[model samples]
Target: MKIKQYRTQFIQELSPLYDAYEAESFFYLILEEKHNLRQIDVALNHELIFSESEIWVWNSLLAELKKEVPIQYLMGKTNFYGLDFEVNEDVLIPRPETEELVEWIINENLKAQKFKKLKILDIGTGSGCIAISLAKNIPNARVFALDVSKEALKTAKKNSENNKVDVTFIHQSILEIDDLKNDFDIIVSNPPYVRNLEKKEIKNNVLNYEPHLALFVEDTDALIFYRKIAEIAQKNLTENGQLFFEINQYLGEDMKALLEEMNFKNIELKKDIYGNDRMIFCNVSKTS
Candidate 1:
């Protein structure tokens, strides 16, 4: 069958679930991945055809897409912060807001007069996106990533290696530990901040397919991970060390208050490109 004809059919079928633009984007992504054909190639070559076997494979993928499986899971990979990462059901797919968090950390540290040999830790580092991005961008940083689930850690370890960054992966839960065992110059986390009551706000593709353990908190204790990690940071962060978090958008003021009560100085709650309060930064002041 002519590939362009299949493309039209693909988009039409998916338009109900996703917009025309998104469905078209998905078609081209699959084309590039499966056939090594770029969008330009497909546009220029109207006669291009999908072999029978290839059609079968694409049909199967289309079925899964109809079921609302994420395309990243279907492709078994994704791009984040200009690097490739292997993603699966074991880890949550990296998001653009988290990339903003990484950029903030990189920019803040890069402003130093000279790059210091800095120790950094990423708590609940599913897929190791933030840690690896920081290590890749900040050459002098020694990065460590910790996650509770063994499966998630396994994926994160592979991602660090694939990105060719030396991020030490720790298979431990942030909630279970009292101390990080080593003082770090920077500590960052994009931990579970979604409350159970907020589940209705989540799309079916995420609520049904993504790892729940990495996404949810009790409605009564929405800041559970943040609180636990902040406590550990109080003890394990070096004097004047910085901490960063990708927070739930609705709880920015609550996050600011939490850090203030914990004596974190220079608290800065910033918005993402969408202008939602999505990230926060603070530094521990030993003297305070």
Candidate 2:
């Protein structure tokens, strides 16, 4: 069957699960990944057809899509911060909002007049996306990533090698650490911030398919990870060092209060492209 003909059916079938735009995007993404066929190629050549085996592959993927499986999980990999990352059930899929956090860090570092050889740590680094992207983009950065889950660290390690970035991977939980053991110029995290009460707001694809361990926190202690990491940052961050977080959109004020009470200076809450309170940056005071 012509690939174009199958595209129509694919979109229609996924429409019940995703919007028309998202469903259409999934079709093109799979086409490129599976067949090296781009949208223009499909458009320019009306004669392109899927072979019998290729059709079977599409049918299998479609079946999974109908089950509301994430396309990224089905592909076993995803593009993040201009690098390809291996993702699976063990790690949460990288989101665009987190990319904005990365961009924020890179931009801030680049704009500084003195280019210090920086040591950076990423807490709860699931796929090592933040750590690898920083190591790749900033040639002088010594990057380290920490995660509690050994399974997630395995995937993060592979992603670091695949992206040709040198990121030290540590297997430890932030909640258990009394100290980071080294002062860092920057510490960043996109920790699990979703409260159990917010589960109803999550999409079925995410709620059902993504790892809950990487997604949820107790409703009463939504800021548990933030508080613990902040405590460590006070002792471990260098003088004038910066701390950045991809925060729960709903808890920006609470995050500010936490940092302020800890004597973290220059706390700034920045919104993502969609204007949600999705990121925060704070600096350790000189006197502290």
Q: What TM-score does candidate 2 get on C-alpha atoms? A: 0.97
Task: Name model 1 segments beyond 4 Å from true.
Answer: 113-115
Count backbone overlaps in model 2.
Answer: 0
| 5-57 per-residue lDDT for model 1 (tens digits) | 99999999998899999999999999899889999998888999999999999
Candidate 2, pairs of clashing residues: none
What lDDT would each prediction earn against the true structure?
Answer: 0.93, 0.93
CA displacement after TM-score superposition, residue 224 of candidate 2 (Å): 0.7
lDDT of predicted model 2: 0.93
